[model samples]
Target chain A: MNIEWLSFLTVTLVTLIGSLSLVALYSFAVRLKAIAEDEVRGAGLAKSGAVVCFVLCGCLVLLGIYLIVPQLGGSGGH
Target chain B: MDLTLIVVLVIALALFFDFTNGFHDTANAMATPIATGAIKPKTAVALAAVLNLVGAFLSTEVATTISGGLINEGDNGFSIGPEIIFAGLMGAVVWNMLTWLLGLPSSSSHALFGGLIGAAIAGAGFSVVNYGTVISKVLLPALLAPLIAGLAAYLCTKLAYWVTKRPSGLSSPKRGGFRVGQVFSSSLVALAHGTNDAQKTMGVITLALVASGLQESGSHVHFWVIAACALAIALGTYVGGWRIIATMGTGLTEVKPAQGFSAEASTAAAILASSHLGFALSTTQVASGSVIGSGLGRKGASVQWRTAGKIATGWLFTLPAAAVVGALAATLTYFGNVGLVLVAVIGFGVVLLIWWLSRKDIIGPHNGVSDVDEAGGAISIPTKKQRRKMRKRQREAERAEAERMARELKKAQKNKKKEANGKTKVPTASGSKSRAQEASAPKREARGTKEKR
Candidate 1:
């Protein structure tokens, strides 16, 4: 069967790119944690909330990336 | 079977699956209330069952998702005709019954979804699979909904306590206001379940109809589909899923009436909101989260992490497992009539095996309730007072045992001092040294050893 190899490959690339965002954000989280720890003025809640927001935003971005990824938007076969 | 007759049978089977979905999830809406003695189990389920039927009529958006989102027309058209849909429904329904029997809150949504995927694949080819739709509509919801619900529950529970620093009087209400709240909340969740869940089957059947040329494209769900699904679900609810209910109500969280009301209310609001937005959010997840939140509401109560862990594991596996099964089933169907026969055989065997396994450690019919019509929980059965008495007796037993141990510890310390030297050495030269060592040993600090380490 002749497949739309380009379309499928594009989807794979998009997925890979989308996955990279997670890695970058994870590093950001580590840095945020270090910063939060260094600053003693904030409540534990604020520190935790900041960490949560970072993670939540990262995930939402990941979802957005997956959804908007050009080739991944459609079922290649159908 | 005649082709048309076979098709009708399949529709009936779809309704049957929808019904099982209703009953299996009844506990999802009302388990905490039942567990807390906030509402009688029978009454809670009865109200839920009625509301679910009414909820089914509330919207068509989720139905459209089922019909159009997952399965495509033409190349990605539904491969399973009525017979295939029937068989798929049977697979899902059998799975539902088995899980209910075992008292496991296996997602009926996934089961039905699995059945369709399996059967469709069996009937068609890899080309028929709508990967995008599967991931976006089904898989994403399956993964995130429960976690979101759990976190929401956790936060909500924390918020409840934070709002009321000391709500000691919450337990003893001057009136039965909490119970009244629980009844209303539970009913709302049941309605939401019906609106979001039952429509799935309707969508599948509609897809099958369009695919088979029995109905035109984009045909609306018929009145018959609605009625059949409603009735089937009501019947399923009536039969009950006692075991799963017990786990949600008591095992995961020690539910109190106020907590139960909060959970049911929260679950209802979340579920209704999700359905309105066309998210086929798992009722189980929403309900479980609400219960976990309730647990949090009652200060000092910790969620049973182990049970939650098991449930998390189940959720993780559900989609991929179903996909594999669907793929295999599809491959077999490619082989035609002979393959269909084998599919039937395997389906029967797998279902029977699951059912047999459920009976292994079954929760009894009483299902952790003692009395039916009693003022609170199974009368003559364990009520709050009885549970408190039992707990008090256990605590006393524990205290006596603890005191005996304390005496023994004191005696042992005295003996050690006698055995060693000079006024119970404090395991250090002086108080500062011992305190220094004690402070350094975090492990020993966790235990907070009364005796110097």
Candidate 2:
């Protein structure tokens, strides 16, 4: 059997980085939102930071969709 | 004339398989969100249905070669025809329904492949199969996909908790955000499922058309074929396999929103990444693995090893069991038209029987989300025999308890009468003590029996 170990390793690495980063970003955004809600000093800064994190998360989701849909330049072979 | 009819029948069976596939996998994307109360069960199925419908239309590229070259298509080798395809589909559909009734999440793709390989062996010979491809592509991926997804989910869950941990030791206010994120992440999984799974049915139907000389080999799937497959799958998704949902959602582990979000994110990322890299993985296995991973990540959260064991066993059997059914169907089909009709009759009968059996312990949206016990153990719906035995035991216990209570009541009344007499004529201390011991002994025994029950 000709197993593509390289491809499998790449998938594992990509999945780890992609999933962990997205979770971390989303969690950080939630943390910022909580800080802003507390209305402490620099609440405006925290709110802006939360928005940026959310936007980045949204971009990651879009990238995932782009990868899934073949019409959108994704490999799309299941 | 017979060929055309056989091809049409094959298409119909293929569509039915697609329908089963839709329901079988709905749990993969929606179970966690529903379990965590991030989405209502009804709304989650509806959303998944719509996204699946749209995802089916996304691409037909993979549909051209759905088998991924697992079957030998050489000129001298035995060719796969509509009859073989029909038998294979029968096998896949039967296995799919059986697993659904048991509320186990096995791989639909593996079932499809196993059925086809079994049918091919029966119809042609062993040489018709490419064992190398089976081992390399199908078996290897099946073993590895879950482990990779599980690891990813574990790390993602830890990261989510670490970032959201509050100094006050209370649940962070931002935990609600994870619920919102879960909806989107699970949606992506649903959409990807639509793209990946629906295409397999399309490929099967198109292959049938090609074998019947109604379509060209290597040609694009017909628009009607695509639309029909998409609709069948979407309808099935709308119906929702609530039993499997109950198992995946609550049977494996209790999910909080943060954990649900982490699991979904890990599932979606793994699916997209694997597909993008041209490595196929079952959405069901990846999702289940993620749920287990998240369970492991959370402190004090326990995984139901029994339920997990049952699921793993189902996975191990999915291939060979479906193969046996496919082989049997293929053997029957060798008898020609009468055989075909018999296969259809038997298949339809089995479907109805499973549906009938499911009614005794129906799992629906109302109870699907609450199918676990308070202690986070899966509450398996007992089989008919088990239920009957349980009822009998309960009734017997009730009768014994009732008899004990009656005896105690009579003894208490006698004691009261004795006390009345003692008021009139001073009773001996030894007699009172003996009466007290007689009363307490049975009472203690009754309490012991009750505790045992």
Candidate 3:
């Protein structure tokens, strides 16, 4: 394969890898949150774990943009 | 060796740096839940692992900071060769393991930075070091990031409660909207993990390029570097980071779901925002802030101020401490190939020794170390404070059960009397005598929960 093609392939692989991770993280967050009501006890801990996942989600969304679109400006006005 | 071969090898070593990073810093993301038992240990780690992997592909801002800003990379000036890259990665990786073995959450980003700085200084001279960038990009953020995140967490947590104050039942969810809110916030943290922590590896790979003369100085990060960094870090996250998870989950804060949510949300926002702006802040520090903030956010959370003090002191000393060690190792490498060989042997031996020593304590997810730590300290000479809390909680639960039983017994007697009068309405009174004898149901439940505790 051409060197350019190899590099493209690599980037594609990384994107897929990232996508899979996001799926896993989202599933964990949702499942963990669902279970908190019954199996998990603490009200405070369950809520926090959930939001922590949300933070992770937002970060992932941002990351998706960062990967798909390279030149987006910072959200915080620079 | 050929330059290309050396380059590949150095990149692999940088990946080794990343794997340790995932393991060492997993606690920063997942500790709050594991400590509070919002998620089981296995589930908590598994979640953190995947999120961290996804987070690595989020951005390359951190990479640019390291490759272009932190170090000077030019031929005949201050470039990091494959050899220096190898040595630097080794230094960073070693420090990560050392801290993990001790169960301290030091900055993996700082360790790598220090190693790279040490290697650059060794390869060329102090002139190649960009102190300004180090201060503004790395150090200043190190100082302020956690504080900002923590303070924000405190304020947001307070505000979250204030906003929710008028609601009827505490954490009652009344409608279950908060569950949806939680999913949103936790995902942000995981994504922030990808965007920020993963970028550090990208920087390392880019730095290796400059060092090995594979890329021109001041060049943008090549796609290969980005891919390699992403792949390595993602793989590392998949493997999981159990030791640091234990420490962070329990050691830093008494995390409840509300506080954990606030802290993690605060941390994710702080880290990703900073990363995008090209500030290479440590996620550990950001997470620490959120945890502390969560403590302040809750009306009365056990902040363990003493433990926070130790962690703060650790943060203060991590960069310089790792820098000193990195410099020492780099200096040793200069004593020719013999020095390199000796350092390698000695370093590996010492790292293995530390690992072995850590196993003696074996504070991990499987052992219910949280119960041991919260119940006491390090399996011996347990904290009197924890013991007191346990006793108090036990007493309260017992009291609550007694009240419940007394109420039940009174109602039962009333029903029994009414039945004799033939105006009975409490039809479930068929087992009144049995229930009176088995009023210990409440007590048994209390005991069961206590057993779990």
Candidate 4:
């Protein structure tokens, strides 16, 4: 009757982290807007930050794929 | 005399259902992006198709859950065999096609589940269903996932607007950036869709293999099954369900780029989490709920309640209707070899009829979102190609009218010249008649001679 506590923790953590990372990426997009008004260097920095944040989000998706890939190899017993 | 033939038939049917599932739910992931002009319709579907294929290779957990967790397998008294599985799949495929024709975003997962449950019960008994698993894994997730995603999207949308708010009538740089981000977020949703949805077919196919004694019980999804299901769904996605896409993208609410981005992000999060948890969730319901939530989240955004109600009603009917079809198909399958052939023939007929009905109102990429306007029909700008085509047609019509007028004018000029020639002839004839008068003719002749000299 014991729950798979580890799996539960992984799912919850991934969901939270994924959502928060998206929010952070959006915040960077917002910052880029404010920076575009003045200071060209600041805008460039914010633009790069947004790109990095987006890439990080993509990495999270890749992590999701990694977790799911084991099922495809037919090696893991469900 | 052979089970192998039925096994092959079941596998083919499973793949076909997977294909229908792909196109029917393409709107769930790509609708918002296409609606907001963040990506073109063809490009969005193409991207979704490729990602969905990759996503299929990503997860096997859900497949195992479907194949092993739901139905009673082995020589147990309640074990439902491969024939029931085939009937269940037929039920699901029929329902998916019906909903797609109606442009309603009903859950394909629910349809499959209902069909399986129904066919299992009809073929074996009510005891064949794993109620605990159904309630815990399938039912609970179906109810909760959408609300969770909606709430997540609602908050995300509110926060996005608050952070990017600008002076009235001024453009915000955030809009352009979010539009670009939408392509990325929606792609994730598409991938998550592949991870979660394509696995369901693989699971069902594996279950069939087990039931038919082709594979051992509790065996992993076969590589061939995975590849077949993935390729089938990908091809379906490429075809694009424009009807459902229109309903979800524009019918429910007008989606701005920011709203589209948040909704997709929320959908991806919810679906990926559920996929990881091995929950058989409905991405269609989750995406639809998120769209409605985003609509309600935005200030002054109007949700088409009627369209939303139609979708909700479809969701309610999806399970029972599919169950009925599954039961009927199972009953037919019980008739022996002839029954299987009969079921196949009838299933094909019904599918063909649905396709024929759909032809009455075809929705294509070019006009997918034209019916519903986010701006209350204020924005009906045609695409550049459409506009150019319209202009060209208008110019051609104008030129034709001008040419007709010119032709008429030329004909009139010729008629006028003929009348003038007739008048000149009449004058000569009158002069000849006057010459018959001797005195008048002498004066006329004298005038003529003087002029000639």
Candidate lDDT values, in order:
0.56, 0.75, 0.62, 0.73
Docking class of predicted structure 2: acceptable
iRMS values in order, in angstroms?
A: 15.8, 2.3, 13.7, 3.6
Q: Supply the TM-score for candidate 3.
A: 0.66
Query: In model 2, where do residues sit more than 4 Å from their true spots?
Result: A74-78, B60-65, B76-78, B169-173, B241-252, B277-280, B300-306, B364-453
Which wins on TM-score, candidate 2 or candidate 3?
Answer: 2
TM-score of each: 0.63, 0.78, 0.66, 0.76
Q: Residues B159-182, candidate 1: write the lDDT tens digits.
A: 433432323553322223345445
Top TM-score hit = 2
lDDT of 4 by residue, B1-453 (tens): 268877788889888888887876676677667766778887888899999998898877789889888986546532777878888988888887876666555678999998988888898888788887787778877877777777777777787777677665555444666777888888998898898999999999888888877788777889989999899999888886555445553363456787777777787888888886788888877776666666566764445556656566767788888888899899998888888888889888989998887776666432343211222222122444765676677567656655665665565556556766775556545444443453344445545643442
Classify candidate 1 by CAPRI docking class: incorrect
Off by over 4 Å in 1: A1-78, B75-87, B101-105, B162-176, B241-253, B324-332, B335-453
DockQ scores of all models, one per candidate: 0.02, 0.47, 0.04, 0.18
Across residues B1-453, which tens digit of lDDT does each residue of candidate 2 receive? 388888888988999888977866676677667767778888888999998998788766446545435667758332777788888889988887787676564678778878887988998889888887677656777788778988998899888989988877544456888888888888988887777778778877887777666776667789999899899899888876555455553354446788778877887777666655544456777777777787677753446668767667878888998898999999998898888898889988998898797776776433343211211232223444765686678667667766766676677667767777776534444465566566567656756654553
DockQ of predicted model 1: 0.02
**TM-score winner, 1 or 4:** 4
Best by DockQ: 2
The C-alpha local distance difference test score for the whole of candidate 2 amounts to: 0.75
- Model with the higher TM-score, candidate 2 or 4: 2
lDDT of 4: 0.73
